[model samples]
Target: MKILNRCTLEFTSIPENVAFARVAVAAFASQLDYTLPELEEIKVAVSEAVGNAIIHGYRNRPDKIVRVNVTIYKEGLEIQVVDSGIGIADIDLAMQPAYSTDPERMGLGFVFMQSFSDRLQVDSSPGKGTTVTMFKQMGLRKARARAN
Candidate 1:
């Protein structure tokens, strides 16, 4: 099954959207036949990335839009979350786990993305916003992970 769907929404820089993004991932996972273990990792990574976009990238700019794109392929699924707000100045520094621009954040978003997905690609420029693309194989690979 080859299906692609995208949604863009703007919400105030509230913490609620963090969970909301995970819920969206869970619904998408159901369509992909993601195993329970796969679903949990996807949920955590999506929440972290979406939360980073809403909190750090937008920095409370409620007017900014966050775009989430989900594509399902025969072998796996890919999810992209994009934000056209303030971008990361240093991709290397931003991706470091436990390193955060804001004191409140533990800066493990990218770390979790890498740990959870088979692949994670991040594209960003200082003023051009950031897009995180994550991919993971379903079915057998997921079952193997759960068995471990």
Candidate 2:
């Protein structure tokens, strides 16, 4: 897809940065004709991706870096969250509902991301790291169709 706008944010892998990443990405995505609810979904997806990077990828370590790359394409908004920490061994198992590496935490992160975005992809290697990509389609066409 054609890129209309893009921005990248790099921050330490801390819990607070999850909110920052979500808000920053949502602001960038606002350039498109997305409804308020659509924007909220995007924010939730961003939070889950970044939170997973900090909690699971870095294992709560505060020094590692988390990168968020957001691109507004002609058809949708794409957000990628990357972390250079311990990666998942089995993506399928991890994606199952309530299947978190940590027993104390709910494993609904992937579920929320998948439900909120048009498409979701996760890439990782055992020792390398993890990258979560989520795309939310612009709502203008949907709204127009509904109006018609």
lDDT of each: 0.80, 0.91
The candidate that wins on lDDT is 2
- In model 1, which range of ten residues has the least summed lDDT? 2-11
Candidate 2 residue-wise lDDT, 12-99, digit = tens: 9889988889899989988886889989999999999999999999999999999999998777888999998999999999999999
Best by TM-score: 2
Poorest 10 consecutive residues by lDDT, candidate 2: 139-148
Clashes of 1: 0
Stretches of candidate 1 exceeding 4 Å from the true structure = 1-13, 141-148
Expressed as tens digits, the lDDT of each residue in 1-148 for candidate 1 is: 5454444444455577778878877787677667788899999888888888988888967666777777776567788888887898888888887999889877788999999999999899888899999987777865455445
Instruction: Report the Cα lDDT for candidate 2.
Output: 0.91
Q: In model 2, how many backbone clashes occur?
A: 0
Residue 20, candidate 1: how far off, in angstroms? 1.6
